[model samples]
Target: MRLTVLGCSGSVTGPDSPASGYLVTAPDAPPLVVDFGGGVLGALQRHANPNDVTVLLSHLHADHCLDVPGLLVWRRYGPEPAAERALLYGPEDAALRLGTASAEVGGECDDVSDTLEVRGWVDREPVKFGELSVTPFKVFHPPQSYGLRVVDSAGAVLAYSGDTGACSAVEELAQGADVFLCEASWTHDPGNRPVGVHLSGTEAGEVARRAGVGQLLLTHIPPWTSREDVLAEARAAFDGPVRAVNASESFDVVKSGSAVRRQTS
Candidate 1:
């Protein structure tokens, strides 16, 4: 299995980075995408056919999901016919939200929901899409959110903490994962507000350590927090290998004993 970081910024797109989006690939199936934030369409075009892609949304936050409409429109009107037939999966209301938003933007909504299959998330229940097995766990974000554990047929698992504060669901989703792609959207400073909505770098590292993940890929970093500081803080909490993932960075998973070797790609 291979994982690509399409974008890793938090809250909004940065000068050098886009918002949150990722792609997971396995040998037997098409690539799977997570969180199509703004600017991800170009990134998605690089590695796989968007028509064969399966999108898993973490939430409806603009930074996490605003690009769906544009992506759908591009697929529908682009020269590539296959791009218009991709499947989309997310929380129960994702299809409605995407369809409504696309129509609002004057895009085609004729069979958007039918073309995109959106299912309700059930904790611990595995949903299969081609060769990928995904398990979504409810998170602590408002309205609703989910942290996903994606496993390939080779037993390689990549767990993503969509966007949430410290929660048992996040830990469960990350348990024994080959790579933990967690969000570090806030600073470790005690004075920071919106306490339980996002994790700090230290908090993300702790989750990785506790989950016993093979590698830690810190993502969803806010613009204000220096990358150096976040990496330093995460290292202090996690003795294991922790790296800050950049946009377009990729990682390959190889079988190593019972664990998986998650090497940078």
Candidate 2:
């Protein structure tokens, strides 16, 4: 499977990137988009038809899922609209949160049933989409959030941390995966930041080291945060390959015949 970085900015849209968003795709399967935050819809249009993909949100935070409502517009009113309702998976309250955000009138959620088939994710239960199986793992975040472990028919695994703090669940989600796309929102300054919110680059690398993941890809670095600072922190913690991913970069993920790790830029 191929993973594309549509956006990696944290908390809010940054000057150089959008909020958190990633595109995962494979042969003959519909594109699976994770965390459709701001600017993702526009970025996705560059690679695939916006109406021909499945969406999965990690949480209801505005930076992680605000673009979903924009997607509804394209699928419903674009030049070539969707032929059928597309599937969207998120936390249990996904329907309510998305609908409320799309609402035009005050205190009313616009009915998104017109173009989206919203589904709630059950923790650890894998949802099959053709050749891919997506298992959502509960993570530390506001409202409801998850870390997705995607496996292809070839048994190649791609794990995403999806904006989590230092938690054992995040390590479990990334255990022995090929590419661990984890978040490192800021520098390693515990006293300066709040806990149970986001992981530092040091924490992200520790998770990768403990889980024995193949490659560690740090993401969700806000524009204000020094990229080099976080990169140094991760490298100091993990001797394995660790890269600070950027917007529009793509990675080809594979396995050595099984669930062993192998990746290419």
Candidate 3:
């Protein structure tokens, strides 16, 4: 299994990266996309055909899923139109939310089912996508949100904490994962910021420590936050391999429960 970081900018698109998006692929299977955020469509084109990808979203936040309309356009009108309808899995009302966001001037939601088959993910229920199986776990985020535990056919697991605060669900989802792609969207100082919305780098480290993950890849960092500061805070708490995500980098997943990082720049 392979994991690619298409973009990892936190709440908004940064000058160098898009908001939040990832690509998970395995041999002989269609790639799975997680959180098609702003600017991701262009980035995704560099890696794989949008038509052949399955999409999974964590929530309805604009920064996390704003590129669905662009993907729809590509799959429907690109040079080689989609030969098969792609699958999109997300929270309840996903179709309506994404449809509304991709609506035209008339304010009428585009028929996403025209090119993508949408489904709502139920907590802890495994959804099989090719050789990968994904189980969503409810996390602590406003409105509705989930963290994913993805297991390849070979038993390698990759967990993602999609824009969550310090929550038990995150730790449970990340347990024994080969790669923990967690969000670090706030400062370590809780008194200086809001609570129960996003995790600090230190908090991310704590979760990684508790979950005993093999590698911790910190993502969803805002442009205003210093990556060095976040790394330092995370490292202070977790005595394991912890790295910040760079756009377009890939990680090879091993069945032995390790993720080998590969730079794609």
- Please identify which of the two predictions, 2 or 3, would achieve the higher TM-score against the true structure: 3
Per-residue lDDT over 148-218 for candidate 3, one digit per residue giving the tens place of the 0 to 100 score: 99999888999999988898999999999988999998769977988889999999999999999999999
Better of 1 and 2 by TM-score: 2
lDDT of 2 by residue, 1-265 (tens): 8899899998889888889899999996789999999999988888889989999999889999999999999998899999999999998888888899999997998889989999999999999988989999999986778999999988888999997888888999899898899999999988999987899989988998999888889899988888899999999998888988878888888884233233433
Please report, as a residue range, the 10-residue window in candidate 1 with the lowest summed lDDT: 254-263
Model 2 scores a TM of 0.95
Which residue pairs clash in candidate 3?
A: none
Error of 3 at 62 (Å): 0.5
Local distance difference test values of all predictions, in order: 0.82, 0.89, 0.90
Q: Model 3, which residues run further than 4 Å from truth?
A: 263-265
The residue pairs that clash in candidate 2, if any, are none
What is the full ranking by TM-score, best candidate first?
A: 3, 2, 1
- Judge candidate 3 at residue 50 and give its lDDT: 86
Cα lDDT tens digits for candidate 1, 228-262: 88898889998888889888788876545334343
Worst 10 residues of 3 by lDDT: 256-265
Best by TM-score: 3
The local distance difference test score of model 3 is 0.90
Sort by lDDT, best first: what order? 3, 2, 1
Which pairs of residues collide in model 1? none
- Runs of candidate 1 exceeding 4 Å displacement: 104-111, 257-265
